[model samples]
Target chain A: MSSPERRTADGLERAQQLVRLKRYEQPDEGYFEGFLKEFQQRQRADLMQRSSRSLFCERLGTYLADFGGRRMLLAGGAACALALLFVRVAPEGQPVDAGFDAPRGEVTPVSAGPLFEGEIDLWEGMVVPAGDEEIDLPLFMVEPFDSRRAAGEPEIIEL
Target chain B: MADVKKRKPDEDRGLVERAKDGDTAAFDELVTKYSPKLYGLVYHMTSNHEDTNDLLQDIFAKAYRSLRRFRGRSAFYTWIYSISVNMTLNFLKKRNRHWKISLDDVDSAIEFDKEFIEQTSKTDPVRESNIHELQLRLNEAMMELSDDHRAVVTMFDIQGMPHNEIAKILKVSPGTVRSRLFYAHRQLQNHLEEFRR
Candidate 1:
């Protein structure tokens, strides 16, 4: 026998030519009939599988609808309860009554505490300084308290 | 095997319609009617009789399940072909591995061809033998193609489907179908070039 590969090549060429020439034909009746039979059997089996799966899905749906459905309802209910619980537990930042605001212009000043006692006051000896020369007390001379500082500005605070 | 007289074309059409409408018996009739072709398709694509049998079962099962969704956009035959092609491609994808091409046990066409060639072999053994070898190699080369290429080849070359019909079935443009056939045939020619000698 010639090399199988060589034979195979010839056959391949012929087949391609045949296919190209539109000479390729379907099988004979007996073969088709056999195929039809096999197809029928397969279809029946397929139908059965589909029905089985359909039945399974239907059963599953029904199960979910019947006894098992409560789980979802319970889940929904649990979610609602948790949400309400969170609403209750979480802090509310609404402005609490900054009790009554006095009318805009009706401001009041409080009485000062007692003046400096003897030992700490070298200031008691000094007269009120002359014109354009306001006497600078240590309290006044020190840098004024910055409101931004008191309100937490300059986030990088020096120790 | 007891022969089940195949349904007439019109009856087959009706069966497909009924099956599409959720009639199990009609679908069963269709399965009976077309199983062999579909099996051949799956078998050729998979190259394993057992795998073909199993895949055939699943293909029909899927077709039956999805029958309700099959709009008669294409002929039921074309529609079923589409299903077969899709299923086969899906199977190949899931396999993610190379598969060899295996023809069904010498089809009548092959048998007849063999007989004709052998008769001629008595006079020109070398030439005829070359042809036989070439055909086998062609089949082997065809099988070595990716499933997509193989599918287009089967439809166009083996089944003699029109480009339009194949395009519709494959959900691709006719140009794509033609290009695939061209490439597949070229590959086959190259693989079987020695036979041209």
Candidate 2:
């Protein structure tokens, strides 16, 4: 029996032999002669298929590379920097409210509920009225105001 | 007496320059010169004539479009061969999972090859009829390899490119190319074991 390395060498040699035989595989006659013409036709078709915009870009890139390799790159960089600076320093087109102290109209306090199960004067530090009887407030009176209503606007009660 | 000729490297360089400058005739000369060689490289990898033809057309078209960037860092031969290998590998990746083995007829001229004669002499006389079958099986075995290994094998074994040339075209070290070839050859041997005897 051949050694492992020797067996491998023999196998590789045989494989190479088989591969050498592959050179005999050739295309039909006149194939090579027509290949150039076919390639030209295909090249034309490809060119026609490409968009004019991409073709322009490709040509422009070639022109720039050939004309000013380093200077053009620096100029492009400077242009981009200037554009960014313009964007950064440009006016936002809106007034700036620096103090945030714009005058708002008077806001009436919204009462949470009766403090002592009866009528209480909210302005007098929760003092219940002396002659008023203890009356149960209606459920509707205790409900939270609808957000859809205008701010600081009092809701009209319908009897 | 026939005149002896020496191929000048500058000939291709001049053609490349002209092609870059939009001379289609010069580019046509390049296409005519390289297409047959590229066809072999692609056809071996694909194992299909129709695919090879379509791929060869696209490869040439791409090379033409990209000729402006051909910076002369490498030989035109090496550069174009690199393009062909890359495009073929990409094509194989996108090819159908159930790729069918389609081989062209093995040229009868191969019978004249010394290796072919010696191998045939050892095999049974009836083995002559099995050439087509053997070719099919070889292609199937080749298809079993990964695209990287297959590329190495196709370039080295079939195209007879030097390991360094394959390495340059593949952008890898010669050591890597040898390793890939070694593994690929082992796989092929196991696959084609029936013919070993």
- Quick one: best TM-score, which candidate? 2
lDDT of every model, 2 decimals: 0.63, 0.78
Off by over 4 Å in 1: A1-15, A18-159, B1-13, B20-22, B96-109, B112-127, B130-135
Candidate 2 ranges beyond 4 A from true positions: A65-75, A78-159, B1-11, B102-129
Question: Which has the greatest lDDT?
Answer: 2
Model 2, residue pairs in steric clash: none
| lDDT (Cα, tens digit) per residue for candidate 1, span B103-130 | 4432335445654455335543335555
lDDT of 2 by residue, B126-183 (tens): 2655766677777888889999999998888777777878898999999999999989
Docking class of 2: acceptable
Report RMSD for candidate 2.
10.4
